[model samples]
Target: MSAPSAPPLKLLPLILANAACMMAMNAFIALLAPLARTLALNEWQAGASVTVAGVLWFLLARPWGRLSDRWGRKRVIATGIAGFAAAYLALAAGIHWALLTLPGILAGFLLLLAGRGAIGAFYAAIPAAANAMIADRTPVERRAAAMATLGASSAIGLVLGPSLAGWLVGGGLVLPLYAMAGLAVVALIVAIYGLPGGDAPLAPRDATPVRMRDPRLRMPVVVALVAMGSVAIAQICVGFYAMDRWGLSREHAGRVAGYALTAVGVALIAAQVGVRRLQWPPHVLIRRGAVVAMLGFLVAGFTAAPWQLIASYFVMALGMGLVFPAFSAMAANAVAAHEQGTVAGTVSAAQGIGMVLGPLAGTLLYGIAPAVPFVVGALMLASIAFWVGTAREPAVARPADEAA
Candidate 1:
């Protein structure tokens, strides 16, 4: 398959579509804690919703990508979006089963699989496809900037999305979730009319189809998993921790968490600008992110104050912001045109796993000690940083031009 040739300014609609979808996805996430409380679940279970969704997102992303490769991205994306909207509507309306069986897991799987799949495929595939699309259309020398443009769309969407959801949902989980579903519908419309359609991008040639087996991805994937895992774990525990530690009420916790997340969004946007100006190698940027994230976790762990946790999160976000873009850039550079979706989806899968594990790790540690989760999470991220420093990378043909 050849790349889909984009029309003038076609990238704008693609970005707008992606931004809308992501905003909805995250807005719904911001409502998770409240949703759990309303459903009478414990903190752990509340966190589990997100963890479960992330796992679903990470695990199924590639399958969706591969499907898109064959069937066409727009079709797969629209299907995913429709399923996602339905799943949320069901969840919002409250679906509970009295009995546990093969069907119970199956039921839970479908709910999350459909809801999460919309995001996993829609968000993951579009970016990967768009990046490749941008790569195909832009000259190689300027591809990095196009990729940068691609990255910015998501960042800008995310920066304001949660707050928007919270304001819309105000006090109800259903409203926020419905808002996400509505956005998914809107995204589907945008995709149908706004997105470019042409011949599909290339597919895997027979040689080395599935596995790159490259250590370049290994180090970054590890970093992403641990770092994202820590983020996920903290997301689960920190609300309760804030309440317990600072005597904050549920509403206060929600407000504070929203604010902190917004700060994270801001940090990521700052990173986009900062990275454009920096001359650092990708590895260096990742390491810096790891160290900052480690510090944030450690600070949050030791904190006796809510304000400290908030402060620490911003610091961690700054580092993470630096690393995330570089990681994506490196992954894009590592593969051939045919395998872009596969590789990008594979990376997203790792992210999903980290998200799933984050809460599980936290819950396990919570049973032992409340603070244990943060410390362990910090150590996990730190270890990944160390691994990256030592890992022997694959012989990726450094592009004739750097991603500068």
Candidate 2:
């Protein structure tokens, strides 16, 4: 089938809502080390708090996705937004309280867990729910475009969130957290109002079962893990990279990060445009994107200048931007309509694992030399291009109800 025309209007509002939540969730990351200092946490203790949040996300993603499948998408998304707002507020309060009370660091560590968990669960609302929402509204052939747009939402948020938070925190440490809360509120409003309503009709009970041997369903998941890992490595370590590499001010780093992030978002939109044109098979596009991402990282790791570093990220994210949608759409294409939640959940869990593993790996290698993790990450991502490019999933023809 030929690809559908890209819906410029369908793209904006949903992405805007996702951006709102993304800003809230990621802003805390820039504050993680400072918050640890307020609670007197060591590097390990501080890092552990962030790791725990990822674990919760990894654990809960499947179950929550299943629930969204059975129940509905909007409610779960709404719940997550509210949770994000609350957690965003708590980060400021927790740090302020820890600074005042007994100087014990455990209080701040606990606060990180509580706050991070809230943010993780709520942030989960946007992508998975948006995937399902897009699935409900679009045809199978055009679904990749929808998923690519969803990916851009998070990238847009990443671009905006840090710069906004850094400016606020430049004014006062507590200010950024409050600003994140405000963004979450706006996201919640958009999510509640702008998104289309209700669950799609589900497949009947007699649908054929999923088997372990189903490459159509499983390969893209593995591909997602590889791409998500690269993204996570960048996500967790970008702030530290700026400070260590060039002695740039946090405010300057924030602005630079914003520019890089916007470029990445553009890459995501670029991929969506490609799918709209249906010029290449998704499998080919995915491998091409991964190759570009790997090269982007190599460029990033070798940069002698900060602008070089930012430009490298642009190169890398552009590659990843295309890969993310192709893989997600591929996974969605392999499944029955009723199984959207299941596939989405599994893909999410895989990405969550990558998210956790990437940071934990970076922090460990960072202790040795800051450059080591990026090199390793680049190598690992390069491995992805080979593995996925060679693997082919055979399409199975199932009954309409079974393919639901």
Candidate 3:
């Protein structure tokens, strides 16, 4: 449990690993519109593939974190990247085969499901291990800002990934998938060579398991789930909404979605940078962000023009930028040092759960009415804002050293 001999961890490698994974994910997400068309899939069928992946992510994230505690952070990270690379390679090949062979819809959907599920099983390890590594190096008072730095890396990936995918999709839908696989391989090599060796440091007393239902984590976990669900709803529905609202073709809709998502990524980076500079208390960030995001979602639901929708997404990203890091930092601050991995994994698991349910609900809601999903997202954020702002802070949530 203790790691006296562990070398100092390099931040850049970890950043690259996290960024690469996120880029690949957002890239795939951004291209879902065109992907659905290419595969001749309905919204429900397309979303079900992601749901399967989320199921695995939710089930395994915490276990991966615990494995990091036992097997070492670097090992887990490398394993994750390796698996991601392999899965993505297979996915790209599958996409190519489907395009050429014109497989049956059920066969194609199942293939997509299997590939994504494999990626999810491995992808769960990266964030949990990476967050725990960051937590290992940071003090409680500075936790939010440190977490913001990590969030910023993912934001950078989000910005580039979709844009890259958008450009590449003109050539072929499988191009981005192949590119993602290559990136994952690079990240894998970095993980193998760039991270510190030895197991994650843990004091013997701090080695005890931290349950998800532990009182300290309860509010933070709830906040993570709701916030992630809101984001997921928008992500899943936005492409279809853009196509329907604008009367655009599949490829054009995918391009527009990419641009809008790029705005989101930029705003996320900008917000996280602000968090780094301002170093606000987690609750303040959560309350203000939730309120801002609520308004953004409302605007997105009502916006008529494609440009307006993109702007609305930017607004939403700005608020989410503050919320995501704050809640994770709050959870990290509340727990003992050894439980950092566990807490990080638990929070990720909550997000995974959101990914599962949110897309399913959003796709269904979109079928009912295009704007309904965003409306529901707005409602969820409104409740989160109300709860975070009004609820009494648990004493454990605020580290004693943190300024009120």
Instruction: State each candidate's clash count.
Output: 1, 2, 0
Model 2 per-residue lDDT tens digits across residues 1-404: 22222232365777888878777666676665555545666656656667666777777776666667767777777777777777777766776666667457666678777777766766665566667667656677667776776777777676667667666776755678877888778888887887655663353567554442455656677777777777867666665677677887655655555555555655655655565576455677687888888888877777788788778887887788778887777777666667676567767777777777777777777777767777887887777778766665343222134423
TM-scores, each model vs. reference: 0.82, 0.87, 0.95
Candidate 1 lDDT, 1-404, residue by residue in tens = 23225443457777777777767766655555554454456666655666667766776777766665556655665666566655655654443331112244345445544555444434545544555455445443344445555656666666667777657655444566666667767877887787666534556445354453555466546665676687778767766666666777666666666666666677666775677677456666677778877887788778766677778777777777766766656665655555556666666667778888887788778767778987897787688677666654443223322211
Q: What digit string (tens of lDDT, one per residue) describes model 3 on residues 1-404?
A: 22223344457878887888888988888888778877789999888888877888889899988887777777888998899899989988998899898798888898889988998888988888888887777766776887888899899898999999999998888899999889999888878888876758643543458787877888788988998888888888888988898898888898888888899899999999999888788988999998889889999988889999999999999999999999998888876656778888999899889889888999999999888998999899889888888887664364322211
Off by over 4 Å in 3: 1-9, 202-208, 395-404
Model 3 lDDT on a 0 to 1 scale: 0.85
Q: Give the candidate number with the greatest TM-score.
A: 3
The 10-residue segment with the lowest total lDDT in model 3: 395-404
Model 2, position 282: C-alpha lDDT score: 62
Instruction: State how far residue 342 of model 3 sits from its true place (Å).
Output: 1.0
Better of 2 and 3 by lDDT: 3
The count of residue-pair clashes in candidate 1 stands at 1
